[model samples]
Target: MNAFTRLRYRGSFMMRTLVSRSARLMRYCLLSLLGTLPLAVCAGEPVSPLLSPHQTIGTVNCASSTCHGSITPWEGSNVLQNEYTTWSRLDRHTRTYEVLNNAVSQRIVRNLGYKEPATEVKICLDCHAHNPTPARRGARFTQSEGIGCEGCHGPAADWIGEHAVKGITHSANIERGLYPTNQPIAQAKLCLSCHFGDESRFVTHRIMGAGHPRISFELKTFSALEPAHYRVDADYEQRKGSYDSVRLWAIGQALAARQQLDTLADPKRGHDGLMPELVLFDCYSCHHPMSDKRWTPRLGVGPGRMRLNDSNLLMLRAIVRAAYPDSSSAFDKAVRATHLAVSTGQTEGGAAPLQVVSKLSATIGAFLPRLEQQNFSPALQRKVLVALIDESAETSYADYAGAEQAYMAIVTVSNDLLSHGALKSTPALTDALARLLKTLRHDEQYDANVFRKQLSTLRSTVGVQERS
Candidate 1:
């Protein structure tokens, strides 16, 4: 089946399975333990492995080369003397608070007229704040520092005490206690923990609510944001001292996490609400106009129930119209179709999902011809490239079917970019895209036919239609 059809059928099956599993687990627990055990005992079970905001920020931020400490760098890549200072002063995640405090965020909040719905209602803190754990760190935790190391890697306290020894270095510290980006599952879980939200542990919010979905995390596409510290091999095993480890970890993690989500099937149970907003998928894959409500990041609210803002969809359409002056009618039809698909309430897996793919294909068919006819003008072709990228949007599918679309999107966009003169200006983009394409092309577990066709098409299009 095509990615579109498979997405819908598989998604539906996965949802039912997830709900069944959750129910069965609950029933078994109730019969085996909950029925006999006290409420406190069940509650006492480790609710979440995630550290509290205070413990994470305080511990991670305090051991620094630039802010908390006197001076000097650690491991060459990071400063050991002033970690907090470096984070607070320069890190984008650290600056999320400033953005939240900005006039734009306040205006959105005022527009929503939310009467301070509690810590969970603080939308900005959802992705920014350290996730709180039952083991509170007294008053040491501060919410303003944004996400800390343990936020991504997990609480280091358990491993920290052991690994901090002067002469001891346990690989488990790197492998088990904290997420080693080396482990594909760990890396994906780490990212999805926040981006998609752990339904078992926290609520999930939409991506648009957090501001820019395009800037948000998608398994395959977002790997560019993280530092790959491991080497990826054909075995998909971790190799020490290979930068490629990071890339391997990403592919494995993305696939594994997406597969796990597919196993669950439903977007409602656990943290299904944490799925990225579908419209964000549109923005990422298609670059069409957004007519949804404006996005405003929140604190404490897990990325579980995040939804698209209608107004932003409108704004995006305006931008697309401005970019493709003659294709306004086509763009309008595509956007309308997209809106209708979104309104159809397709879960992570369903027929409504296929409609999205159909719409994207339609848009691409309309614009790609224009690019070819116009001799692939850098400016005009850029729009076509953007549409191609948008065509790869897989919000629901990524959470269910896998990151295949995302990877394809990257590969196609990179080709388009290189064809349109991006390689000369931005060599790194070219290199990164090339490496990713190579990995995708070679990965045995991935469907070779899809990559083969896409890579072939992309190369042929660039070679024949563009000026070298």
Candidate 2:
């Protein structure tokens, strides 16, 4: 059957009843559950049933009155009365249509002369639709409700019907369809399912060519939607009681996602007729043409164009030093390249406008010979792994302008190390981590206010104690 018809059949009765009664049924069940539980149990406000497995996804399951479908706007809230309409019309998630249908996507397809921009069956539905139990998404199925709730979270069909009935326990929820967002591994699995496709799938042309934000997704920052879809508050005695698991899950997800992206982005393969070096550079990185056509590549992927203006490679070198002090040449070469990039960029007339990129290439060239000369020892490889984690934690890309490309480069290098299993087992890895944390602490502006809130989330998520 065609994709559209498949959706019609699968949607069936579940969609109409589930969506229509969503909010009221959820609140009713939540209130009842809270009433029974002791007051001392501080799980704050009833969780939106969307998080529960008992709620159907992609079946018009959000239409129930007083639930997401409530017609009378909830008190003073401006939330749309019908979540289905709101999600389809107002939510950015639905706008994937504009992205696929846009001129740019068309242009790329024309340039490549492919039959389509996104393969209707293989690439499109990977992230856009849902995956239900007892029925795997066929090779050709493409359900609408693009980027449906279940696309990010796991399938709910198994538990959506069973979770809310009186006496249905959380453990049972876990067994049926529930994916504990609080668990780092589970959260990572759910997210990487789309952002970084599983082993069964290959990165699609659309995902690879989409501009900036569209090209990549971050876990720590992007997962903020949880606050909207779930209960997250600082009012409690311990914030841990609320956001601990979700937050840690996000951090782990970020780390794992990066590793996955790096693994798939084999500069060695050189897909799309580009060199390994070119592949290593994110699409926006070198394509960015500012005044005088100084084509600087994008530091990070995606719409925000966030770049962390720090010596990322230098930091990676530091990680290498901490983990494998013997790899002094590799570490030093990275440091020298970073310093040269900065000094050259600051030259007269903005460092000769675009000559800095050439100088940067020269630095890499100088390092290649040395890098190639020495075989990576097990100890050295371990250091590279430690460096990856340390560098990732040390550097982040948040805002658009003034992002230090050096640190961004370090992020790429670190990701490469992690993907290669550099830190599989070694004492240097532990030392490098401690060193990275110490560096962040000592640096007055390391965890700036803007990042502190986010970092705090990571700390809680990882179950780590606050630094004294």
**TM-scores of all candidate predictions against the true structure:** 0.44, 0.44
lDDT per residue for candidate 1 within 1-468, as digits (tens), equals 543343344334434443343334323322321001001111111223353232342444455443345443344422244444444454456655556666556554554565552233444465556655546442555656666555555556556555545565435564434545433334555566555555443222232333322222344334432322211232222222222211322233333333223323335442335544343232212221245232233211123333322222232233244355676666656545544444444434355643553444444434422322232234543454444333323122212122334343334334334433453424444444444344333121234334444544544444443455
Best by lDDT: 1
Scored by lDDT, model 2 comes in at: 0.38
Give the runs in model 2 whose Cα sits over 4 Å from its true position: 1-57, 66-68, 71-90, 116-121, 131-142, 196-216, 225-227, 234-241, 244-285, 288-468
User: Per the 3 Å backbone cut-off, how many clashing residue pairs does candidate 2 have?
Assistant: 32
The superposed Cα distance between candidate 1 and the true structure at residue 151, in angstroms, equals 1.7
For candidate 2, give the lDDT of residue 216: 34
Please report, as a residue range, the 10-residue window in candidate 2 with the lowest summed lDDT.
33-42
Query: Residue 201: error of model 1 in Å?
Result: 7.9
Q: Let me know the TM-score candidate 1 reaches against the reference structure.
A: 0.44
RMSD from true fold, candidate 1? 19.1
